[model samples]
Target: MKSMAPTRKLYQEIKDIVLLSDHRSSMAFEVSDEVLSTYVPVAVYWIFSGIYGLLGYLEGCRLHPKGAEEEENVASKLQVLRGVLLQQVVQIAVVTLMMKVVGDEGMAPQQPSFLVCACQFLIAMVVLDLWQYFGHRYMHVNKFLYKHIHSKHHALVVPYAWGSLYNHPLEGLLLDTIGGSLAFLLSPA
Candidate 1:
């Protein structure tokens, strides 16, 4: 077995550097890490959306400019927003179901070591990427899926941060929500 002594030492050094408190979690209110995990993704989504939205305003940062023929948006902002909202509802339902199924005992009280956490994150990324890749490819290859479902996402001519989440409700659930849930469940704690 690989010795965990070095890993523990590195984790302690990281804790000292970050000045993390053992008694307190990152949030101001007392909340379990398991519960906090659910909120983290939502927070990150908005944070990235904001960053990408800001980037859209910068000409130098844009891959395709506003006037480009190919970059024009076919779907209206309202349409995209509605799709996003619908997907969010589905996502919330899935998350609620997952939470209920897992219950309080799902997560351990002690946090995983930094190295372990990093490895888990890497694994999750690979799993999610693979899931998305195959799922998306399948959707494209299937005429019924592309026309009725995947095409909703393709309606956005110019990809923007806010529009990134705009997907058909079913497609979003299958490609994103299920893939994410699988990644979360499959990853070692």
Candidate 2:
């Protein structure tokens, strides 16, 4: 019985992290602790991407300065950045919703071998790459689809760091949300 105490405590701690506490609110959206926790890594991505993109831009524009003709105006870049931020908000919402749906069903760690975990991660990435390639290819081939959904992304004549997520909602959900969901779904956590 003494051995069960530590395992039980660990489970309880995980339960505290995964469970949703606020389902009722008058606001359009509420940022709960669970949501905030998930947002941290994504926020880090944006920060690092922005920094790298800024450096790249400065290098290209200052040192080499080749594509000045095609370089977009600051206003246009800001507009695209706004769109990226909006889509990130959508992503956060989708993640929160998925968490609510998946609940605590498979949160337990299986303590799989390093090789097994690496293999699962690799397989998941390959699947995601294939889906994204096909999904991206299809969106471009269909003009109507591109004009409606994918054009926003292409508007960035020369994209910056935050430009990574300037896609429209349709493309965003199909590419980002679905691909990521597939990876997590395939992995045993």
Candidate 3:
């Protein structure tokens, strides 16, 4: 142990310098992949949205320069976000239901090479976009859906990145959740 101490110190130093890491982690990957996968997307989505929101703030809201009444913007965004979150909960429930009903055979493990995985992801992205685009178009054309299911998304006269996700629960679910899940389902193997 004593003989290896110097080598360990050198390795730590290299990690700190070359990797730009100053802290050492005593923890391991103790969480199950399923647990991680379930929560990571929500966490990542909010975080990325926050960063983009911050950038928009810093850049003087160039993306959507129009200003709304403070109460209207805040309350509208809050209400929409609440509904969006609820839709995420429902999506999770739906996925759980499907898993129980259909079984896990569809998600059989894969040992694909990087190239194959990349190709699958590219195709999945295309499918996701198509689904969302068609769904969104449908919502716009349907008068009832436009008034009830998608009007919230159009509340903002002009939308910044932060406002991109401000929408009715059903609209968000139809476009974001379904599109994303379709992509995952298509490439899950």
lDDT (tens digit, per residue) of candidate 2 on 1-189: 368988886766555555633333232244644567569868897889867766765655443355642565333766876777777887788778877887565555456788987988898888789889998999999999998888777776666666777778779888988887777677665
Candidate 1: clashing pairs of residues? none
Q: Which ten residues in a row have the lowest lDDT in candidate 1?
A: 20-29
When 2 and 3 are scored with TM-score, the better candidate is 2
TM-score of structure candidate 1: 0.76
Output the better candidate (1/3) by lDDT. Answer: 1
Candidate 3 global lDDT: 0.68
lDDT of 3 by residue, 10-40 (tens): 7886666656553643332245345555678
* Winning candidate number (lDDT): 1
Q: What is the clash count of model 3?
A: 0
Candidate 1 residue runs with Cα over 4 Å from true position = 1-20, 23-28, 67-71, 106-108
Model 2 CA deviation exceeding 4 Å by range: 1-37, 56-75, 105-108
Q: Write down the lDDT that model 1 would get.
A: 0.80
- Model 3 misplaced stretches (Cα beyond 4 Å): 1-27, 59-61, 64-75, 96-110
Residue-wise C-alpha lDDT for candidate 1, range 1-189, written one tens digit per residue? 999999987776666556656543344245655457666777787788889878877989887867652447788877877888777778777877887886566545676799999999999999999999999999999999999999988888777677888888889999999998898888887
C-alpha lDDT score of every prediction, in listed order: 0.80, 0.72, 0.68
Best-to-worst order by TM-score is 1, 2, 3
